[model samples]
Target: MTTRARPAIAAMAYHQGAFVPFAEAGLPLTTQALQYGTGVFEGIRAHTCADGGKLVLFRVRDHYERFLRSCRLLRIETGHTVDELVEITCELLRRNGTTADTYLRPLGYKLALLPGTRPGVGLSGVSDALSITGFPMGAYTPPGGIRCTVSSWVRPRSAAIPIHAKVTGGYVNNALAADEARAAGYDDAILLDDRGRVCEASTANVFAARSGRLLTPPATADLLPGITRDTVLALAADLGIETAEHELDVSDLRCADEVFLTGTGIGITPVNEVSGHPIGAGEPGPIARSLAHHYARTIRGGGDVRHHHWLTSVRIDQG
Candidate 1:
């Protein structure tokens, strides 16, 4: 959690544009997404690939595909197809390669929405805005397991807002919980549903393993249907590990043999404790390490072949 602060961003790519300095990756203040969180986005990881540092994006196709789905759901007119988004993302990374751990974000926002006569931002226009930014980031480390505290803030009820969408505004919930956790002297926070069922970490999707079986919250449980979460589940299935998608409460975490969180930035990381209780002796369990290793291989190109559909190669010859 410590480093020499670097420039915020070196370069960025807006729709149909590339190699624009970060400063130029701006929009009018009246842009719909800027006025109201009306767009969706996806977080992708481009790891150092092959012997030549090719920077292959793990599951780039799937990420862009979901981004397309999100745009459709939001009624945004995305001018490009999924394949075009993939091409642009790869090109952006090739141009702005960073030395440290990095993350890629592509935001699809409503560019033309206007404020209604009531003085409130509304979905008056349907055109979308997409921008790609690649930056360096890392997470707080735990020597044995990440220690987390329950958050005082509850997740937004799905009936109020579609909690599943990766809208930038939805992260206000995460920000509030994370701030509470940090002030509570913890590395992260675990949020509960309106009904008090355990949801997920502030930003990362969560999973638990016990008695050789894995369990995680269902998509309907007010959690994002996370791409990395799905990939981890599939990897476990390939290894003959049984996984169950169900709603779990705090008691499950306190008694689980292991707990791990996954996301685009860090892949899979072990969480050894929750609310100050040790999870299976406070060390990363076999399931956690196994999934982590397999995930690393699959992302870095050495996992089971039957599941390679989730991966997208970066060897695209743009000539």
Candidate 2:
């Protein structure tokens, strides 16, 4: 019954085109992004390296690439390249004096004040805005593990709305599903697609292990296609564990040897139960634990050399 943790706000944040005091980083109430949820954002994690006390941003380029794609899908112009966004984010962290594990949120949004919901229509004066902010962050999921229930809410299909984009409006559906789960005393909820197949958790990609192999719902299942999920699959393959992408059912989760969720925010969180049914031994399974350990090591600039390519160092000389 524990709630998710959020870091305290930092003193400085990058807003529009300049760094400003966090209190001054405000948008107009009538902005189109606020009015109609026409915004795209990415959540990236930065970690402190034990060696040389360096700070490292994980997968900055990949996140920005996805961010740009999301902006394009929403017709919001970022006006910045992936490299520029990375540099902006790095500068934001540097100016904020970040020294510990932190989370970076970069957002692109339409800033017009028009009232109608017609996207890309009747907007002659609208402009796009971008912002990057960061703060200390910790585990997004509860420790030990979490219990999840299947949400009554179904994921929106791609035809109805581009399901691949991390559009702001779409997350209201996630908030509803998560609120329902929390109200019911569960840690989180698993969403299903229109076809009644397992899609993902409220904010993370879902994975289940059976017969020592890992399986997750395909991208077509309306999941976010998380970077952490990709990292886990790679780590699993390196560990000699097989992985596959396919459709899943709640029964598949209940009967699996292990169940877990992955994301930049949550890392690898074991699911001990689903819909009141205990999964396997009702605890974190061996495969999930191994993947979590490997992920932690890799993110902190440890583990395999190949994994090091994913990190972007933020340690700059202050002199």
Best by TM-score: 2
What TM-score does model 2 achieve against the real structure?
Answer: 0.95
| Per-prediction TM-score to the true structure, in the order listed | 0.89, 0.95
lDDT of 2 by residue, 1-319 (tens): 7776656987899998999999899987868778877788999999887475668888889999999999888777878999999988888888877677889898899897444445554334568899888889967676589999999999888787677888888999899999999999999999998888999898899999999989999976677898988899899989999999979998899899999999998999999999999999999999999999888888889879988899998874444
lDDT (tens digit, per residue) of candidate 1 on 223-286: 8878899998898988899999988888998889998888786578788778788888798999
Local distance difference test, each candidate: 0.76, 0.87
Residue 111 in candidate 1, Cα distance off native in Å: 3.0
- By summed lDDT, the worst window of 10 consecutive residues in model 2 runs over 115-124
Give candidate 1 regions above 4 Å deviation.
1-8, 15-18, 97-101, 112-119, 137-143, 315-319
The local lDDT score (0 to 100) that residue 212 gets in candidate 2 is 92
